[model samples]
Target: MRTRATVAAVSGALALSALAVPAAQADDSAASYPDVAKVREATSVRAEGEPYALNVSFSNVKIAKAVKVGTTGRVSTAVTYTLTHGTDVNIKAADFVTDAFIYRGSDLRPDHRLFGDKPAKCTATSATTADCKGTIEVYPAAHELLNTDAGTWRAAAEATAFNGQDPAGETFDISKVGYKTQANRGTTLVQRASKLTVDASPEPVKKGKPITVTGKLSRANWDRGTYNGYVEQPVKLQFRKKDGDTYTTLKTVKTNATGNLKTTVTATEDGYFRFTFAGTTTTPAATPAGDYVDVR
Candidate 1:
């Protein structure tokens, strides 16, 4: 008979003291840090059992096309895999753990730590086969990735089989035979971020008089966690009246160095003026809030 189970992971707790202590009253010595032994145990990766014995393999891996980040929000990618063990072995789904990670640069290390790995949910299809899926999360604001996380990234999948069943003994050995690791050298891109802003001079303007509209275009600079001008790029100037539900494109203006914008239009009615940017392969599109102008 077959049984289903979900392994639960132990949750770690963090403690903080609310009471303020003077610098002189506190222990300033290096001994104040956590014990070296506990730190090593928590940070170090455990050794794996021999893979040849487990005969573990992966197939049918699917990684998302791209990941995007901007001021508005962030994007995550889905990764799936098929896990198979040795012919005679019958491994339960709950006895295995899987993970999917996104890495940057040629070293293929998670050095940037730009993205976080998520645990996989695996279901046993047969005695030797299981299907697993997981996601990699990208955060622009929290991680300060901005445009920096853009470009090609490496995706990897890894799984491990414990010696015993779920909620079992804690002393089992972790080694090669207990683990399987595989990766796809194929690349996925993270698009750059785009931004736009608009304003109209003279809050109240005379009817039929010339009103100047101005704005700027910028994109995230990954290295700096800030935005910089996107020069020589054409942007659309749009307008929508108070009662109108849709905005109509009035004209197109190209950005100059430093991503500055300037244009003029005759005041016809009270409405909003805004700027829109058409994104490129490296950058994602963005539209800023409208600047209201009152006409007398």
Candidate 2:
């Protein structure tokens, strides 16, 4: 499914306009941002319903290294890129607007997308070259991000020039507007926040006695702003000797109905213990600090 670009001025360097959709469809991905085949019964440009390609290209596009989105609030990642355009194209024009965003799926026709609440601002290094920067904000629950939607997402951008024409004008012609889009400029991970905790009881135990290790595995709940238990997930119980540099997996334990992990190990040497979760498609791996124990 594709989306249409609409006019609603927001904040930021690209603070010109935003894509407006029906209020009732705020969380509907296909109805939110611009991607493809957007036009209505209006002008000739609207006739083709395809945005005419403008003379512009995006290069050296870089998205934030970590996109760890949580529940409750918006997660914004900074985006920086280079934009090259023909000399005839006036990027400094009052109505010239361009920005980059991220989408999930295999194509530019996005079914789900994350857009900056503000527009990107650009600085011209030359008449034909410019540096651009912006942000893409993700509201996990609002955009309907699923556990399957994590891992990697494609990067893309769009530009629009009103060309002295009012998009909201009664006589407006989308055909007269200049537009361009670049897809697959690069890719970035869209990972959910995960948390793991560990605790070993009877820290000072006899060398040959039993020690109990326990932990909890949890991940971000985008709808509730909480790190809820990740039930029935497998978590590794790892131990590292105080004199050793590496941690060895002592055993693998599955989380209980409430994401709690517990297991027994025989005390042999003084060491630290921790829990590790390999993670799922929607969540990133978690390895928290270890809890130290003493063996008498």
Candidate 3:
């Protein structure tokens, strides 16, 4: 009887141990799992002569592992984009290129590039869409490549419409259409490093006083070593008194190596002044143009 009782106790202990093994293994697996999520593209559109507006959303967002990365445990998310002409204009979709870049600290890195397959026909009744998609794969070594201690990441999408085969020659239209990413684990997703805007301030220059108006055309991701893809052109600056008034030619100055323009305007009289910055690749309507300052 004693031997049977000992045998029974040992058997019960073994069975309990077998049941606990899987639970222990499950806890370990859960601890080792990495955080994964899906991302989407947000878009904004502006008419040629209208205030900038956004009709942003997402479509066909999918998440999976990147087979090229060679890590089955790693994962990536891909999102597709579509474009259409809201007006009657003949535009080639192939003339545009989509870019995807990753931000690490103050440095922005180009991760992917996609060119349009063919020219899109835009007519009064014509509408078109293009697949602008990107993927971010999560790997064990991804942190090393990105070099972020907080494990935070940021991304942006831009469309550049070209007129010629030269990538850097003439740009007809450029706009930032989309930006998205996962919840950043850091203080802030990398801030927009490059921004191009027209500025006209401290106006009412006395005639011959050399009214200095500085217009900034700045960029953040330009690789300093490779000149950040800098191009020189004679940008024209036009000044006007009112929104509907005809613009008076101020000066045409050449962009420096860094794409900055500083000009001095001698005000003939005290009146409202507006300025426009026109790049070589800018269209008459799409270029940066806005009211500068009101002369009192």
Candidate 4:
């Protein structure tokens, strides 16, 4: 199994440097702050004979910026498996599916759902002959909650044969993949900005203010393509009045492939406001309070 560079080594250096500087100096520094640490690490399980060993590695894991409200950034990992026995083995792609399950605590039960799908296969030999290696990319759904009260999370990978064929089964446990301590420095701002402004007509909205929220999602180091994945699905803008207990759904909109949206909403109050954007494949991103101002 091939091992790529670990995220901790890369981000850790940045974090240490950020911590070494004076508080005031650090505040002025342009270095990007890491919202989540690469705490949970896992190595792929290697199996012998019938049961193949699969190894997975993750990279570029970090926290989403404040502008990334309702959305969470993720790390990409590659899963590799080696088949020892040359004996003809017919394995369906789906059978080798790999899933990522997150837990709030050390206990595995009541695991919080993250992401799941079939592993991507890269075969060097013929489709049905000899040895094969499969790979897949897994992203955490609730990446925004990584370093919060939700506790540390551990990831486990399970692979099975096409059918129930159990010629020989072996499971190798890995430290990097299992359970580990997590750090929560609170929400790390990936993008620097003041507020999100919404333009609407009709002076003050008495009953409801019809407005549009327009903005472009951008990242300094990350490319636009990576950010677009979060906004590809249908999204809803959730709103609430100042000092309100619960939020109400204002309007729904879909982000184009470029991660841009001009969502429409009906303002309900004349006070501080926030916007919660929800999507299917990605976690929801929210605007900071005071981002919206209402005059009613």
Candidate 5:
């Protein structure tokens, strides 16, 4: 959904602001929406519509990686928080509930909501304060789900309190009751996975004959649940002699539109041939097992 760019300033080392959600909704694709700006500090945030006064503070927000590429890799982060109730209210363990989630867009208006909401463990630090901890898991498919483009995203926290010990207990209209929302502006990056493979033919070739080495270069395509070719990327062809442990680069080759690699080398002795790839910002480096060739 599209959000209006109204900035709200929060007090203290932590910063939390609300972005107004307009009636309009933006397309799911990251290409369709503008990148959300990064928030450097933790901001204070207040939940709307709750009759009781509550304060949610976020701190020590640790994101596993600034950029994550594939399904094989996950966007992970741990967040810590303290919840304090007003003088009139008292909270204990399990009396209040909190959830942690990641969002892209503005504070109030998010174009994409990722890493489904999971509960945070809250422990009582005092009669009115609770210290809570939780995590966010974003996989490669998450990128596809958000239609995320390579860029930075935001993190948010939400909390709910029951009028009594049990939320399901009959007392007030559960549907009508509102919860508190606390958000911190930290950025995490998402990218694609890069992969490579190699195979050498004519395992027992006569010495001095040409040996053909073939390989493919590909990247994770979450949309397809398969790896697609990463065309035009440079790959290094290396060889290790049977008597030696060190591998020496023979030549540099580039992938074609289909990410295929084929080259020929003269057979001198029993050795192993392999391909290596240098990764990019949006992709992680990957290498397959070496192909062995036996020469007589």
Candidate 6:
């Protein structure tokens, strides 16, 4: 139910595409252009839902605790759940498709919701129960997410058994379809990927001489499909002796407007220098490989 059946939770328009529009009919409809009323009617199945639909429940819906998305690529996680329905319902029907999705803020926000790129696969364990598996996909290059979009998002599960019905028909009757939706299935985190770098130059240095340490802090920018400097953020400057097993925090420094870091420390013993960021609610913490400098 992906490209054609995947529900796009946006305004009350265009989402009717989620219904049982077959390939041949879908192609013809694309050329003929279906009416606006027919569109809204199709999406209403899961939006407002039918009062007299089939009885099905989504349980043990296990999605990853957090989904991390970086710039310029896709991120996806496997999802599994138990689907229970009345014996009268045919989950094995060719048109039967059910899946879970995650959304944030208002339900009407399209950018806040995410779905699988492909339909879920299910196997029946009993006459009334089936185990379903699927994946939730996110595209950072699509610009569907922003820094503020990171954080907790609500989950929901919906099933639509077309049962040989035309979901996009102007006179479509939802009451005749086997549709079910369970909201607030739980919560999951959507976070931005973070990156850090450190460079301690002037390899061989005289003892007690001033040495320079530099680096940058960056995070995924979904809007630009690239990593951008995270400015005005506190970063720790740490140093470790050549023979030490741990690093000691020397001083806390903040990133410049462009996320660049630069600090001076007196050269003493040979050691490694590194920078670290605690990260924010939206971005994950990053600790890059430490840079080493030799002291005379």
Measured by TM-score, the strongest candidate is 6
Q: What are the per-residue Cα lDDT tens digits for candidate 1 across 34-87?
A: 121122122223323323334677777778666666543556778777877776
Q: Which stretches of candidate 1 lie over 4 Å from their true place?
A: 1-50, 53-66, 70-95, 103-115, 124-133, 138-149, 152-156, 162-188
Candidate 2 residue lDDT tens string, 90-126: 7766556677888765453354566676557788898
Compared with the true structure, model 3 gives a TM-score of 0.30
**Which segments of model 4 are wrong by more than 4 Å?**
1-209, 216-231, 266-268, 279-290
lDDT of 3 by residue, 166-263 (tens): 31225312232222222111221221122344666556434546566655554322112111212365556776665546766667766677667677
Candidate 3: misplaced stretches above 4 Å?
A: 1-194, 198-201, 220-231, 270-291, 294-296
TM-score against truth, every candidate: 0.61, 0.76, 0.30, 0.31, 0.62, 0.78
lDDT order of candidates, top first: 6, 2, 1, 5, 4, 3
On TM-score, who's better, 2 or 4? 2
Cα deviation of 152, candidate 6, in Å: 1.9
Best by lDDT: 6
What is the C-alpha local distance difference test score of candidate 2?
0.70
In model 6, what lDDT does residue 29 have?
Answer: 32
CA lDDT, every model vs. true structure: 0.59, 0.70, 0.32, 0.33, 0.57, 0.72
Q: 159-255 in candidate 6: lDDT tens per residue?
A: 7665655655676655566656677787888888888999997889999999899999988887677888999999999999999999999999999
In model 6, the runs with Cα more than 4 Å from the true position are 1-51, 107-111, 168-172
Query: What RMSD does model 3 have?
Result: 24.6
True lDDT of residue 18, candidate 2: 45
RMSD to the true structure for each prediction, in A, is: 11.8, 7.4, 24.6, 18.5, 10.7, 5.5
Query: Which wins on TM-score, candidate 2 or candidate 5?
Result: 2
Candidate no. 6 TM-score: 0.78
TM-score of 4: 0.31
